[model samples]
Target: MALWTMSFLLTGCVIKQHQSLSFCETASPIYISRDDVLTQETKRQILAHDVVGERVCGWGRSNHTS
Candidate 1:
């Protein structure tokens, strides 16, 4: 009986994982105007955030759409 129940649980069970679960959104913007100057380290961090947002749960973006 226990084996039958376990089989049933395995057949249709799904694990939904969200990227945001792994990464939290930044409270402040990582980037500023294009005219603003950024240090190399800052640029790298921004790029990393952008790449993650593109492929992941769509975090790291402005609160509203442009």
Candidate 2:
């Protein structure tokens, strides 16, 4: 019973957040989390990764192929 309860809570918080893959892909970092206090770090990490990935992708696309 205890294990089931713990699993349910964990699933609600972490798994539920990612279930919406479309939301994750389309939503900006600002819309990632509604609770500022709880998701500040998560938002920061996501934003940093997105910025770096976009920069790298842009650079790759512009680099000389010949």
Candidate 3:
């Protein structure tokens, strides 16, 4: 009984995996480049609430931090 149930569950997972691949094929492409990203000046003015001095996400300091 357990073996039969396991096989049924595995077959359902395989079918869902094929469907996911088809969905991905119809999705739009994403382009990411340094130039396409925002500049420091724009970030300061637009994302002021999220910015604190020069720290962003506890990573590096901003250009004005020094």
Candidate 4:
């Protein structure tokens, strides 16, 4: 019974450590903008570029954070 309890505690600690490490390895969101007027074609071109994640765009807003 004591050995079983120790095993359970050790397993829990390992699982918690794995979870924390995975969270740390995760990437944060990225935001990009252009300085000139953006046309629909420009936006489409930007989206068509080689990438591996989602993209979101907003206009005339003042609540963005870096």
Which prediction has the highest TM-score against the true structure?
1
Residue 11, model 2: Cα distance from true site in angstroms = 51
Per-model TM-score, in order, reads: 0.40, 0.31, 0.23, 0.25
The lDDT of each candidate is: 0.63, 0.52, 0.47, 0.47
Q: After aligning candidate 3 to the native by TM-score, how far in Å is the CA of 5 from where it should be?
A: 0.3
Residue 31 displacement in candidate 3 (angstroms) = 26
Among residues 3 or more apart in sequence or in different chains, the pairs in candidate 2 whose N, CA or C atoms overlap within 3 Å are none
Clashes of 4: 0
Tens digit per residue, CA lDDT, model 1, 18-54: 6562454443335567577989998788777666665
Superior candidate under lDDT, 1 versus 2: 1
Candidate 3 residue-wise lDDT, 1-66, digit = tens: 999999999988874434344423343323234555777985656445334322424323323221
Residue pairs in clash, model 1: none
Q: Clash pairs of candidate 3? A: none
List model 4 lDDT by residue over 1-66, tens digit each: 999999999987774434353322453333445545778986566445312223222222322344
Give the winner by lDDT: 2 or 3. Answer: 2
* Residue-level lDDT tens digits of model 2 in 1-66: 999999999877873345545433554422333434546786677667556545644322222223
